[model samples]
Target: MKKSLFSKVLFVCLIIPSVLTQAAEVNVYSYRQPFLVEPLFNVFTEKTGVKVNVVFAKKGMAERLAREGQHSPADILLTTDISRLVELHDKDLLQAVDSETLEKAVPEKFQSKDNTWYGLTMRVRNIYSSKRLGQVDLSYEDLADPKYKGRVCTRSGKHPYNVALVSSMIAAHGEEKTLTWLENLKKNLARKPQGSDRGQVQAIHQNLCDLSLGNSYYFGNMLNDEKQKVWADAVNINFPNQANRGAHVNISGVAMAKHAPNAKNALALMEFLVSEQAQQMYAETNMEYPVREGVAVSALVSSWGQFKADELSLETIAQHRKAAIKLLDKAQFDL
Candidate 1:
């Protein structure tokens, strides 16, 4: 009986360590689509043997995290757009990270001042003009030119992407000038601002409009789709503001949760994401430019030719978000 009891205790002791090891996991609350992030998590798990649990939602991640407070199981928050990152940081939902790997990989302009978040990839706001239009070079300022009146196509001005762009405009040119630009841009729209970025591309292909504003990646995505390839082929990507402030660029970024349950594993994942292998995968799989210096972009993205990106700090741009939204409303852009 004594021998049997000793064996049972030993068995329980061995199982405890196994269970503890298996519990080493990092949970992610993400605003990015699942397919875009799942593969990276799978790779991270393969290399580190730490499991990853993800909860993806189209929006409201910050609200959810705020509601969860200290009891939240989330270890990381991955999302696109500096505005969203700033929103969470402002709400104190994220914790500052001290990773040299992240600091070294991300540029000063693309990272938080407090090291609360790091940009993972970049996507430029480019002008897509119909091939027949003969407008090879364009500027964001020129989009409002009277000559182009009744020719521009765009999504809703209230869309996050456009708000960010307008925010950058407010950063470069102040609120009054940005407001004027918005009014003129609204006057120039081909129709009531409606549809996705790709829809603008489709409008351009159908000759419904002469030009549209869209992110660089959508061009690549459209080209990869059979039906959309024609729309993609119909327009030439013109990097706006190349001769002046440079094209406005936005980022997809990551931040550590304020009450991370697996902080160590989260840090490991953050470091791994900025590594060369992961940066390259980000470029290839998402068609976004890698935030890490020296990482090559996908061949397709590279073929689009290089142009200077706006040097404005994203934090500064984010600060103008409220003003941008107000200007959009004043301009009645969606009307």
Candidate 2:
């Protein structure tokens, strides 16, 4: 009887390592392009011996998660924009992360109130102007100025990026004022609101419009591209309202999936993503600002000079998303 008990104990010890080894992996569902994120995962794997498996998708993450329910394999969801993260929370596709590391690394303004999502990096919604205009200083509110009528260009107001911008507007100026701002800004469009942010820069290059709104990273990206560098050269990147409330900002962020099969490894990955090593990689590789203070900005990104970002809580801006969309529709913004 004693020999049998000893054998059972030995057997349990032998299997535990095997189980732990098999469990040392995290699965990810990423809305971000693979090229943009794979390197960070590679480094995390090197450091922790935890394998990361990614299923890249352009859309439908929410629907997929809902369908998969409690059996979903995805442990982490990496996505861009506040609304996307908020959508996951509202849909109950995410679970709260109670990591002290995350709470310390990310600012309260950039994380969900319930700690379900944490911002990884930041991008400014900058106003770009033709060099001919020479260092234009304007606020997001100034886009409505009749003086610039028929001289501004932008992507669809309904695009998530612009929608976030409009939400910030509503937070700053309230519904009625933001709607009027949207209508007047629409009247200033050089052509119909159209094309990608790059296309708006191209409009400035071609002299079709004198100013357009675009994310700050697009400037660095355009400068790196062979064809787009010329377009990048045509404009000066402006961080608006520097003297007042400061420029509006947005983020690319991550969340812990509701049904994470590799729960421990998933939490580890989330913690690593906010680590100094990962934050630095994001800044250098993606031309974005690290959410963690003290991570260095790339030289090219730094050359554009620094400006204050509006410190309003992202949670507050997200609350205004529906209102922003409503005003856009009521104003026939894209039309």
Candidate 3:
């Protein structure tokens, strides 16, 4: 019998998998910068004999996957911010991951209540003030004070970081109260909201403002980066709302794709990512807090000293997002 071209092609395709099986691989679509997340993938492959193929983009990974649907090639979604992950989950794009290692590695405060997403690191919204100004009672709410008028600086209120913080405020307070607070805060701005959180710190050092809001990691990076040392040396770090429940917090998190082609491997990767070693890398390298309980906070972070973190579930922050954005607009936060 003569062999058909189609039969030969199909036979080769079937055998190619056995040839490729010698090397296990995983594909990741990440909204995080490659330098920040690639190191972990390298670490994962080293320990598990799995090679990771990554595609990093600043935005649109979610939309790309949603467009691709079950045909999506992404095995995992790595991102920062609770809102993004929760949005993915709400859209039914993420599948629940019930790994014991993940549950043990991440605390309840950091991970999704439904186990749809797992937090790998934590960020705290913090305040930075001039040491020259001396002791200060800093609070996110205090940003609204009349005394700080023309002495306050911040990134644009529309930024996700600020939006999430505002969301938390709404949950803590209410729509009416949040609107009032944002209006007062707008009146105090040294300059219209502009620049990255780090830029706000730079403005303070330049004497452009007496205070600014930043993520705790920005302080750590500033303190360590040679380029930012002068700005870092000039300020004192203050954790907001210590007198109340605590400062609002956020996280860098991960989730399995709804149709993960490599579900078992992805679960393994998720578990490994929350391990002590990975958490330490997240804390030390990124200047983020470890999601796990016993891991020591990074030395750089610790030097800033300890303060309370808001105990509210992060999901509540996601839930209040719309209300916060509305309040932001109604209060003329941009003004």
**Residue 101 of model 2, lDDT score:** 98
Candidate 2 stretches with Cα past 4 Å from truth are: 1-18
lDDT of 2 at 209: 96
Candidate No. with top TM-score: 2
Which rank order by lDDT, best down to worst? 2, 1, 3
lDDT value, residue 169 of candidate 3:
91
- Rate residue 14 of model 2 by lDDT: 100
Instruction: Output the lDDT of residue 284, model 2.
Output: 78
Off by over 4 Å in 1: 1-23
Model 2 lDDT vs. the true structure?
0.93
**TM-score versus the correct structure, for each prediction:** 0.94, 0.95, 0.93
- Model 1, span 1-335: residue lDDT tens: 99999999999999999767646789998888776788899999999889999998888988999899999999989988888898899899999999888988899999999999999999999999999977578999999999988999999999888999999999999999999999999888899999999999999999899999999999999999999999999999999988899999999999999999889999999999899999988778878999999999999999999999999989889999989999999988898
Write one digit per residue (lDDT tens) for candidate 3, span 243-307: 99899999988999998888777888888888888888767888898888898887778877877
Question: What value of lDDT does candidate 1 attain over all alpha carbons?
Answer: 0.91
